[model samples]
Target: MAEAQREKVIRKIEQHLRKTSRQLIKIDTEEQALQYLSDSFRAKLYCDFVGVVFVEDDLFVPKTWSGNVNEVRDTFPLRVDHCSKQLLEHSLTDKEVGLAVDECQLFSLLKKAGVKTWFTVPIKDELHTFGFCMIGFLSYVPLLEMGKHFDEFGQDVAVAISMTRNREMQLKKIEGIEWITKNLSIDAPFEESIEEITTRAGKGTNAEFACIYLYNDYDNCFIYQPPSYGEMKAPKQVRIEHNYILKEHFPFLEKTGGNQMTIPISMDLKTIGVLHVERKRSGVFMDEDLQILRLLSNHIATILENARLYNNEKENRNRLHFLLEYQQALVKETVKHEGFDGIISMLGELFNESVVLFDRFMRPLTYTMDREEEVLIPQLRAEAEKARRKVNPHIVLTEYSQTFSIWPINSGGDLLGYLAVRMSGNELNDYDQIMIEMARNICSIQFIKQKLVLDATEQAKENFISKLLVENVENHESILQYANLFMWDLYNPHRVALLSITLRENELEGCNLLEQQAKKAVVWDYIKVFAVEKTKEILAAMFKEQYLFIVPAEKGVQEFWPQFYKDIQEAGKRSGIHCDILLGVGGKTDNLHDYYASSEQARQALNIVQSRFKEKGYAFFEELGSYTILHQIDNEKTTDLFLENQLGPLEKYSQGKNMDLIHTLRVYLQNNGNAKSTAEELFIHRSSLLYRLEKIESLLESDLSDAEVRFNLLMAFKLYDMRGKMS
Candidate 1:
């Protein structure tokens, strides 16, 4: 080459390099720097094509190009074989090397574009070569002398490009961090914030996709949180271990051969989750990408922690407010004396659930939310028993295709009943629990108040009834006036019933005096309920442990008495109460003043059941044929004198013995002197009865063949049986 031409080429190259340096000084991004580099080289150097190839996965990938290379642009990326390897080696050693179509296969694309030769210059920093800047020529040009001058210029170009790339990368890191920080400052929802963080991290790291997986503490796993923006597909859940890799947890991802970076989102030294980014065929992430992701992960952790705390506080506040409102509503209801019905109505309305009020016996008394028939008393009682046995105050029973949350109503440790809230599902949130608890407490107070009123009213009724039945009060006008106050029209004749109840030992066992008394009250409640159902209209009162019911003298009374007894038995069994019931039905009275006579008849009949009529649960006063006659002879002294005269010696002799001569003689006479019949009735052999008969005759000093003697003995035995049962 001539000296003047060389000087002109050198000056033109120098001028273009100076202008490129000035253009890059104003550039703030890497894309603009690379585009200007290609354009400046192609236009200023008069080259047909200028392409910037970056090292990607050990291949030279053309990232940007200028001028005429569109025909072969799709196949521009070339693998680093021996030919391209030689060119890279020379470029990295600070040599600008030229390539011909025959010299290297990488130059074949330029040849196809009508270029004869192409040469490469390395873009590098002090320690590493990032890529090569390739210039292609369409015509043959001598490059031996030009290559020397361009080599020195290539060093300056490399420095400028490397500096521009680094500056742009730093600016992007700042912008990404600032963008995430600004979004975090906004009061967006937790999910929205998470989406923003993932988006920024993906963009900042230049990754193809990004996503987050939140650590589930309860499940001890990581759950995928799908961002609204991202193309990454991840598993819904993963059982993560310490130092986990995405491909290890999800093996299907391994086939993609992509680069994955997982950064732990941490708060207070605890890893809450992971921020993950993936690079498909784009290649691996750089160290700067990792640093930027770490900062984003930290911010995400902060947002998550804040959201957790905020949501918890908001929930607590809402719960407290709800409880206060519920308590206020209950207090108002109580003040108005609306009782159980109102309380359940409020609960049903507020919770949109069914509510039932049960009596202490677990019987459904009132219900709200149209759930009257659904409240099964038998199931409720069973659940209540379980709760009591388990020492749990509340229990949930799921049966009959429904669920119920039962809160026991107790006052002073005495369980009143239960407030049952029928649940839509089996789970109860803390708010539901709080509301139910408050309802239980309110019901307990109402129960105590109702008990106080009931006790006072019950005491008055008992006093009036006791005067009529036991004291035989004779003030007719005054008695009628008092009866009217109890809604009883005693002007009509009425029959009296006496009840003797013996509770099973287990029901009262391990109970204190008050507890035992409470149990008795519950039994009384059950008896009252059944009695009213049978009689339709009755005036009843409880005294000591017995109940006295006064019903109209209707023909159904006969059936009512028997069925009432049977009903009590069945209910007791179903309600888990084991007991014995002895009932006595008295004859109808003529008037209110004659009620005392009927009551006395009922007493005598009940007495008969306790002693002689042991096989039957109830007895009628009019049905006691012999006992009625004996009881009608009210002169106790005369009956006693006759009893002593007839069988005093026999009774004195049989006092401590298992055999009773008086009973044996009575059975013998009552059976019409047929000893065989008497023996069969007594469950003994005839010889045993004959011997007892001989013994009784010997003791009484009378012959067995006298009808007068036998009659007198029968009378004495009847008195003896009646007297024994009465005592």
Candidate 2:
């Protein structure tokens, strides 16, 4: 049996290498060659089964002949993973065939098949093991000399596997390069295309992980896109200072310990990105893999650079086309209502980018972006405010990224507001700047038209209010008709509130007129709120130096009046406007005639508020319980004569002697004849105050206890204080 087996082994080696070598060369694919060898060697080697494994990838995938694939593959104990320790021990020393039953699980499998011996011949060259072939026999004799004799057959199989694997590797590398370079679309999603290239490169080079790190001119750093099988969220970005061509450490590799290889991806021999691949488990590597990786990196870099250039050319073409179309549309579209609405819409449609239009007050007239729904109101408001503060009328591009460019819009030397162009990629170039400048020029016409319409409407509103306040009430129907024409709710009960703001002379000292105005108006916030109030439902206007608010008198609105007054007065204080404020609230009046009456009374109450109270800045006509009677007497002669008849002698005496009699008499009357309270009020001694009071009585020639005299003297003191400033 030994002699027969020796002869059979010799014959099989000669036939497999010499005769089948020509057939193996004809095989075009690795799978065909593997299957052909496994099936042909089973019967010739006198074995129950045969299996072939080749190292073309990170795995030793076995091609089995003659049984269930899993059952056959599961029995092998010399697989790359199962025999890795033993293989390393024999990496250079042991390369012969083996039939050790105690060392392999295949022994049990062979026993079940009634086989007594099993042989596994490693297919390897001097440098590395390409693959191995395994065979099991029933009742074959164990020969010590056959181990060395099988070396010839093993060498033959190793040569075949090496040729197939090398051919496959070259073809795969070429295909990978071509796929990435020629197949990817210029309009494809840039990040997604990059990820696909990384995945293909990993597969081509037998790497467990792969990544593409591209240069970001905006951040001045490298951004990593990790492999799909890796930590998906990992390496979204990293700040790598050095270029990939130089030896720089990747911070992402610190946590993921592995044997890694990185190649600089270049376009026209200039590195712009990096290609990184790693083996996580055992760092399976080869010279062929590194060579293929280098090729892939070059291909990926060229693809990216070409795609970027193509996209830029396409974008420029689109922009030029849209500019011409927009100019045509702008010239054709006439103003319907709020003439700027159409222009803003055109701006959004043409740009296909983030475009926001703000008025001079930093209030958004209209806005649109790439993803408009994702934008927050505060972000728009903040960006608009920033654009509003820039003094330059040309486009101002921010540093680092070209995503945002702010252009101030002006016409006839008056700044209207700003046009902000924002996007996601490269900064605004000269073409973008020129396009925006033209956009601004075309848009200014609408701005002027809107302004003209606004001015006409404002003039009409002022005319209506002036006529309502000053015209004769005999033609009240004509006045109501005119109010209805301006969309004013004249049928409802309306009351007017006047907010008078005045600045002291010195408050405007260190500031220019424009700066002073800006300070007084609170710049952005106050102007925004005031513009809103004027344009929306509230009927407000800037008349003289006061703000006029004509509003509906709804129920429970009176509760807000106190806080509203405090808010405006606090605004004045904060603005350094030293404002003297007097708010006279009119009573509710139903008819047009009574509306005129209410306004007249409101004016009268405002005129008398200073004379009635000392420190009160506000007065309500309904709450003026005793002062209502005082507000009725408007004749200056009556007031002058009353003051003269009552306190003329005391005034003369006080001026002549510089005594406290007049003051004491006034305090006593205010105190209702209580000397203690009167002295406390005057901050004097009670006995001295009483002496002054008696002296005053002796001069007036009247009893100190007369109720009629007390009443007349109190009225005289109030008139005396309001002598000159009364209106």
Best TM-score goes to which candidate?
1
lDDT of 1 at 109: 57
Q: What is the clash count of model 1?
A: 0
Across 1-727, the per-residue lDDT of candidate 1 in tens digits comes to: 5888888877877777677767776786667888888988887778788888777777778778897667756675667662456454444211233334455566655556676666777665466666777787767766544554455555666666667667876876677668876777435777788778877877776777788888888787888887634675667688865745645664433132337777778788777788878764366766667777777777678778888888878879987997798889888898787467888788778778777788776777777755454546567667766674454444555555666677778888777887777777767788778777788888887888888887787888887776676545666666666777777777677888888766678876887887766665666677776656566577778855567878788747466666767876665554456667777778898865577788878888887787667567888888888878887788987887888878887778888999987677777787899988999989998898989988888877898789898778777766775675222
Q: Where is model 1 more than 4 Å wrong at Cα? A: 1-54, 57-83, 86-188, 207-284, 298-302, 337-341, 361-363, 368-400, 413-415, 470-481, 504-520, 555-560, 572-575, 632-666, 698-705, 724-727
Q: After aligning candidate 1 to the native by TM-score, how far in Å is the CA of 451 from where it should be?
A: 3.5
Ten contiguous residues with the weakest lDDT in model 2: 88-97
- Check candidate 2 and list the clashing pairs: 402-427
lDDT of 2: 0.63
- Candidate 2 has what TM-score? 0.46
Estimated TM-score for each candidate: 0.69, 0.46
